[model samples]
Structure formats: C-alpha cells, structure tokens
Target chain A: MASNWEEFYSSHPQPANLSKNEDLLRDFTARHLNGDTRVVLVTSGGTTVPLEHNTVRFVDNFSAGTRGSASTEYFLDHGYAVVFMHRVKSLQPFSRHFTGQKFLNMLDLIETKDGTSVTVTSENIPKIADVLRKYKSALANGKLLELSFTTVYEYLWLLRSACQILAPLKEKCILYLAAAVSDFYIPPNEMSVHKIASTKPQTISLQLVPKILAPLVSLWVPNAFVVSFKLETNKDLLIDKAREALNKYKHKLVIANMLQNYRQKVTLVTQQSSYVIELTTEQSRIGEEIEMYIVKNIVDKHEEFIADRSGRS
Target chain B: MASNWEEFYSSHPQPANLSKNEDLLRDFTARHLNGDTRVVLVTSGGTTVPLEHNTVRFVDNFSAGTRGSASTEYFLDHGYAVVFMHRVKSLQPFSRHFTGQKFLNMLDLIETKDGTSVTVTSENIPKIADVLRKYKSALANGKLLELSFTTVYEYLWLLRSACQILAPLKEKCILYLAAAVSDFYIPPNEMSVHKIASTKPQTISLQLVPKILAPLVSLWVPNAFVVSFKLETNKDLLIDKAREALNKYKHKLVIANMLQNYRQKVTLVTQQSSYVIELTTEQSRIGEEIEMYIVKNIVDKHEEFIADRSGRS
Candidate 1:
C-alpha cells in the first residue's frame, strides 16, 4: 500500500540502538560459526506499530512469546547455539520460568532484631535451582545471545542485520521466524506527531505492511533452512494459508496453527508432504509442550538438509 | 460519538472477572472502614482495546505504571489502605525494582558433587531484603489490595464497582485515577472476529470513549476526593487541558505533566491555583522520584477536606 521494503529502509531513520545490537549480532555469529555446532536465530514475541511519533499508544499482538521462549529452551537442550531475538518485555528463555506474581511465593522474607533477609522457601528451592543452573550454564558456554526490539522498524532492521551475519554459515544455520508481526502499519508520513485528541469520531488509515518474508527467504540468509509460521482463527484456512506462505516464500517449511489450540497441535507443511505434531491428552495435562517434538522434527530435517547440501555439492 | 456511558455498559457484557474482583474490593474496603485511617483507590497502567474478537492484536498505551506503583508504596507508608487496580503485566509495587534481567544477577548458583543449590549473593541481599520487608509488612497488615484488568471495558466496569463499594466511606476515600485510558475504540460490529487480512489498505473507525469521569464525580462517589491526570507531549497544552478537565469533571485536582519530563516534575492543578512539584538536580541525579512530593501534597489536601467536613458537622 505504500513503499517497498528498501524504500521503507531509506525513508525511515535507522533505530538508534541498531549499531550496538548489530555489533552484538556480529560477535555472536562469529563465535557460533565453529562448524561443529549449528546455530539457529529464533525470533520471538510481537512487534508493535506505533501510531504516533511520540508514542503513548500503539497496536500490539497478544503473543506472550510462549512458543518462542519455550522453543528456545528446547533448542538449547538439543545443543544448538541460539540467538534469541525477542520483543522488549516479552518472555525470555530462563527468566520465563518465574516472571509472574507466583515468583513472590518462592521467596520467604525473614525478620530479625538485627535487620532483615530473604531466602528461597525450602519447598521452592529445587525449581529455582534448576532454572538458575541452566541459565548460568548457557551464559558460561557462550551458547546463547539475547537481543530485544519493541517496534516493527527495529525488528526488521535487526532481522536483516542478523540474517547477513548468519548467512556465512550456509546450510548450517536455521532461521526460525515466530514473532507475530503486524500485518498493517500507519506509514511514517501519515502518523501523528502528537497524541490524537479524542474530541470526535476518528478514521485511521493503515497501509499493508510489506511482506518481509519474501525478501527474508530469497535474498537474506538464502542458504539457511527457513521455517515460518501461519496462525489463523479459522481452522479451514490454517493449512491452506501456511502452504501458500511456503509456496510464495519458497521456504523450507511452514508451521501452521489455529489460534484456538496452538499449544496442543501444530501442522508442519513442507513441499512434499504435510504432517502434524500433536500433544496427547496425558502429555498436555502433565505440562508437556508441543515444542519438544517440533524441535526434534526440525533438528532431524535440518540434519537431512545439511547432508543433502553436502551430497549435492 | 457513540452512545452514552450507561448505554455502553448495557450493550457490552460484563467482564468475567468482575464479580471475583468485586468481592475483593468489598472485603478490602470493609476491613479499612475502622475510622482510624483513610483509603485510596489508585488506578494505574494503561487500558487496552482489542482490535479483533479473537484478539491476536489490540491497542496499547505506553505506561509502565511507574507513577501508580511507586505511589502505592508511599500511600502504604502513610498508613492508608490502598486498592491498586492496574493493567495486567504493568509494573507493581516492590517487585518493579527487580523485574528485569538484573534479577538473575542477584542470585549465585552453586553446583557441587552433592547437588546444586542457589543463594542470594552477599552484595545483593541488602537491597532485596529491604524491598521484601516492606512488601511483607503491607501484605501482613492487609493494607494493599491488588487487582488487574486488560481491556477498557473491564476497566470501566471495575471502576464503577469499586466506586459503589467505596461510597460508604464518603469523604474518607480517595480515587486517584492515573491509568492511561484509551480515548477511542472500535464498536463490536466493526471489529473482525478473525485476524484482519492485510492484502490491501484498510480504514478503521474509532468512536470516542464516553467520558466516565462525569458520572464518576457526580454520582459514583460524590463525597470522595477525586484526582485525575493530563499528560501532554506538547508543553503548552499541559496546564490548559488539566484545568479544562477539572472544570468539566469538577474533581478535586488534576495532575498535569509534560510527557518529556513527567518523572522529573508535575503540576498540581486545582480550581483555586496551580503549583509545581519538581525534583532538584541533585535529587534527579541520585534517582529521586517526584511522586514523593506529589503524594505529600495530595495527603495534605485530603486531610484539610476531611477536617473541614468534620468542623461543619
């Protein structure tokens, strides 16, 4: 509805933090290019579209980054170096375990005549210890790099930079695009500089956000195994739309999900065949995530892809 | 632009959590009605408007609830019962100090041959101890009641219920409505049940959210000391808009602040005159907040109003 992706880059100013994050991405990619362990860039959470220049209000998506955050941990468990790019304030890999108010329940405050102190309750120590150990292990091994963005502009800019950095690894890299990106945005030229006063009925015009996956697949990180997602409210449209994305973008696979029961099941749509990785009733009830199976499937396929590329070469 | 506030309520279904939260409000207010101390209902954070029926997206405001959360602690310090109704996931009292990634840095993980354990490192214990003590004291005394809402519809419904429950307190109650409420929203008929397709340019019509303060001040809790807020990106409109709101709503005070330096300063506007409360350069450098002085001023005004009424009777 407005400009092409390149024009969008030229017109909009680069995010102030882009250069700093780019440096981090470059360093992270450099370290992970050991050829022994494959690296994956997993994008999580949702990008916002600010309606105003001085943004007091913006459009947001309802992803808590559960799929991405949970998936990052599973990917790490499989010994993959993960560059976890997420929306600011959304869930992260390890911290996601205890971010809610229930975190307060874990700590016991002690009072004494001398002063005060805080200790993890005897009952709660095991869970905290487990998460903390894994988090520290990830940091010590330098296997995880975390980056965050809030707006669509920042996300796109950072995504491009990350892709360029990871492209050197060729088929050894995997690009997992899971962030719930905005489909529409108010163009920079049309956005309000001040708060839109609420004096009367207002009409807002939104332009179609340029499809970044097209360029992301073909131009950026072309050799990487690209897996995109399609989430729909209507069950009938889910697989068809996912297949459409796979055909159009020419990516490795499409993960199709319905908004109603995304956690319980996800369909993997590929060029040759499409199949589902579903959680059994017991597995779901006992707190088993579908991500464990999804990651296993992807790791297996990625192995085949790398071997196939080597065989062809 | 749409129907009146009453009509809006009748048309929209009540939030599922309303009755549960109402019980909390009733119990909290009943316990605080001992004639020993006053109570304040402090609404914080920002209300959202869902864009679709099955909401993958919504409109959100940019308030981390720094003001409301900080003020809740100060109000608790002053021995006033506090009802902290806020937007879900926004910052809250005590916990706001350490919700970020730095929370991880506070603990040291010890891995030994026996097993693994975690502890609060010596350096970090002091700060966490202080916050934990205060948080426990408030909870133990039953002085703070926390409630949360996401949508504007839920916010309005909850506000009315809280007001009805607090009306019995008369002049002893204060309603500090500081939440960054949305000014406009889409009607039910206009919103898409599924995600809005982004193949073309789209037009979204937003109707003005009816001014609930009109009914709130005149009918909801007429005897309570009510305070509202006006935040402006433009400096020139700040004071004028605050005064306009006071004249229209006939509330006790309006806190006016420029978006740029809201943390550093704010103007307290009443019918008689306006005065500024600002943090000194020394205070600002050491991370002193302006809410301390603002809450002090409001407490003074509330005390005087209570005394005046007592004398008249």
Candidate 2:
C-alpha cells in the first residue's frame, strides 16, 4: 500500500489531459470565489483500477452516478455554484434525465420532400422542457463546470487538485464525495505493461488504496464541510462503518447505506448523532428521489457549520 | 481450470432471466429459419466477473461494444437476420450512432405558453432520420433480436442457449464472438456472499475460467461458422496468439487486433492463410469504419463455406 500521498502522486504519471482540465477548473473557481458564491464540489460515478498499464481490462465499481448527478441539480437549485466531477461516459446532470432509449422514445420523426424533421412528442414536452431550462440556465450563468476522469489514478490526482483550489475559499466550499472510489488498486510498478496472458491460472494481488480522505480533511481543506458516503452490503456493519469513518477522518458527515436498499433509505452519520432518511413507497412510486432530501439536510448542516465558524472568527 | 464444460455449467447457476430471453430467441430463430434466412449471432461488449455474489464491484474487459454493434448493422444491411447479444447498456446498432451527450446535442428545445417541445436541429435531421428508418425497418421485419447480459456467468449461459437454438440450422448459423470475455473468475462457491470489505490489503485468488469455445466448437454448433476476436496490447503476440487459438480450437477464423490500432487495422487469420485489412486516414476521416470491410469478408467466407458443404453432400 502506498503510505504517502506525495509519493503516490509522484509514482503515478498524471493523466494526459489533467493540465488542460486544471486550467479550466482554475478559471471556474476564480470566477465563483470572486462572486462570493458558495461552491459545492460533487464527485460522481466509479473509478476504475487497471490491471495492466495498457488497460485491456480493469476492476470497476457498479455506479451509474445517479446519486451525485441528481444531487447536483438540487445544489444548483439552492443557489450553490457546482463543480461536477464524474467518470467519463457515466451519467451527468440534465443528461441523466434522458438515458437509454428514453430520449428517442420521446421524439417523433417527420419526413418531407425537403428533408426529415424531429420533434419531441406533445405529451412529453413540458417534462423535458423543465429539465432543459435548468440545464441551460446553469450553463448560461457559468455556475456549473463539468470535469471527467476514467481511472483511479486520474480521480485521485483531480481530487487533490480540486481540494487545493477549493482550500483558499475556506468554509464557503462543500466537498460532497459521493463517487464510489475503489478501495484497492494494483501499484504502478506491479501492473503488467501489456495485457496479462490467460494461458494459465493467475493470481492478482491488490494493495489497499491509501486513505486520501485523511489528508483532505486534516490538511487540504480543514474548514470545508466534507460529506462522504459509506456503501455496505451487510446491514449490521453500515452505521458502524460510517461512524468509524467519521471518527477517523473527523469529517462533517458520512451517509451510510446498504447496497440493496440504498435508493429507498440512507442514514446520515456524524460525530454527534445518526439519523435515518427514508422514502415511503408512495414517494418512490411518484418518482420522488431521496437525493432531494439528502441535499436539503446537507445544505442546512453546512449553513450551521459556516455560521459557527464565522462567529468564532 | 474447468476442463469439462458440463461440470462448469452444473456448478454455476443459470442467469435469472435466461429462460425468458431464450423463449424470445427460440421464436425469432424458428421464424427466420423457416424463411430460409441466414442468422448471425453477434456477441458484443465485455463480460463482468463478480468478486461477490451481491456484486458491488467486478472485473470488466475494456470494450464499448463498437465492433459488435457496428458489425450488426453491416450484417443486417446484407440481408441477414441478426441476434445482438450484448452487455446491458454497452451499445446497440441504431443507438451506437448517438451515445454520451451526442443525442441531446443534436436537438433544439422550443418553449411556448402551452408547453415546451424538442426538435432535431435542421442540420442533424437527415442523419438522425436515416438511422431511425433503418431501426424501424429492422423491428418491422423482425430481423433483429436483442438480448442483454451483465456478468460472465450470464453471458456464458446465454451464449450456449443461443447456440442450442441455432444448431439445427447448421450452415445458415454464424457466431461472431466479439465480446471481451474474462480469462479468470471466482467460482460461485468461492465468491463472497456480501460486498468485499476494503479495510485492509487484500489478495483475490481467481481460477482459470473454463474454455467454453472447446465445447462451443465441438458440440454446440459443430458446423456453424465461428469467428472469434483476439485483442492484444502486444503487437508481437497478436497474430501468433490468434494462430494458436485457430490451431487449438479449429475455428473457422480468428480476427486479430492490437489494442492501440484496432480501429485502423486488423488481421483475419485462418488455418490456410492470414490477411491484413487496413483503413487509410482519408477513408477514416470520411467516416469509413473497418467493421464494414470485416463483415463483408466474413459474409463472403460464410457463403463459400456453405457452398463447399453443399458440394460435398
């Protein structure tokens, strides 16, 4: 396992497009901070761990980024400037509302002598328009900035870079670490340069991924409200693990959930107390997402944290 | 390693949706065979090997289903009925033309007092309409059957089931195996029942997955035209490995490709000879895909194989 964050960054080469993305991010942050806008960094989707340097195959976490993508809209609605970092090809805000064959199903095609035309079906227009309006508004105001990464190494590098930029903003920044990051990864020196041959039985050894949250909480953005998610399959261990993470990282919150029922229920675990937030059957049937409630609670908690810090100063 | 295919099948449970999908496949094949139409089974995308039965994380091959999805369209245009079996959410024939945010980017949203509407931009209408027409025609003619799988076990089960239904047709059946299947997997008994906790360094032991191609060639569809893909990162081993597979399995063909330049070049290897197919920069820039050539060659070979068999009989 890599014990030092600096060493880990040095050992792994930066992603080819990191500098370009960093420049864009820097400008976005500068504009938001200058306006005295509270910025929320929402990390979405899963990070991949390549088995080979060339990466013919990799280990992936199962995340469509629904939680983070859905939450981004709520943050924007609540007047927070949003930095949306996600996995490439994973779901994104606004785009998440139209996936699979949904967009195609909603449109009608008309052919004429001149050419063909496509239009959204009459019944679906109002619904699609609402989403489009929010999406366009965010883009127009430059309140939303999108960045993407594919591999675990890229994710870590980008996360640190984001924290470095957000750090100076102090309590005005909120880091919503919702991405399902890989806990284990093959070291750079240990990974095969080429695709591993399958002619014989192979054993893959993975080292524990260093807890970057440790540095991010204690050093990078100490005053920022940091919220992390703890997803577990075993119900018995869910709250305990979330509490443990809170104690160890000394972060503001750990949203604990079981994999099977995460969509319906989640527990907000903090240093002081724990509370469950769940959706009723009726609410879920009517297409009410739990992220709305989750974001509302986080926003309230963040307000209190900021107020407490200001009073002390 | 599982040397016996039957034993391997017995050890793993069938996919939960296999029976439902098989019913659809059987009806589609039976209907097409009665019409004397040649049927091609195109397996696309990558298979996932779950580390846990609950499956929070999995080992996945690097494939966007580009080869299989692109080739499916070619096969359809050539008057062959297509069975597109792919990883869930990977890609589809018509949908491949619009992925990520491309579909949304091509549209213009209009708002009014009554509601809002979405229309394909005038410039993009002709292109979208052309694809839509092809998609609608395939459905109307019942020439396309879509089935999906996520895990390696599910893929293996569905592949065997598809072969069983296609076996009686003999020379009319084609198996285009383009899916990036995993070489190693954890057996059901060995897989964790819950999500694997990542509190410490972990060692994951994987057994060699049984070579299903052995039975698929010798037993399941002995007379069918089978074309498998060999994707390698090392240029030196690409052709040699393809040849080795051809020699061992005695399959009709092995399409060999190096990971870096796969879109531009590929070598088709047979027992008798090997030939390289390549696309120039000008051709690629004009939107020419290598799959078009690849499918054409496969179709010609399948025709020759049928002719030779008929002559012998």
List each candidate's DockQ score. Answer: 0.72, 0.73
Off by over 4 Å in 2: A1-3, B1-3
Interface RMSD of 2: 1.4
Model 1 chain A, poorest ten-residue lDDT window?
A97-106
> Which candidate gets the maximum lDDT versus the true structure?
2
Q: Write the per-residue lDDT of candidate 2 for residues B1-313, one digit (tens) a residue.
A: 4466788789988978999999998899778877668989999999999988887999999998899999999999899999999998887898788876677678677877975678888898878888777887888899999899998889999999999988988999899999999888887888889988886777788787888898899889999999999999999999899999998899999999999999999999999999999999999999999999999999999999999999999
Which CAPRI category fits model 2?
A: medium
lDDT of each: 0.88, 0.90
What TM-score fits each model?
Answer: 0.97, 0.97
Give lDDT tens digits, candidate 1, residues B116-204. 66667878888887777778888988888999999999999999999999999999999999899999898988899998777788888
Model 1: clashing residue pairs? Answer: none
Evaluated at residue A80, the lDDT of candidate 2 is 94
Clashes of 2: 0
TM-score of 2: 0.97
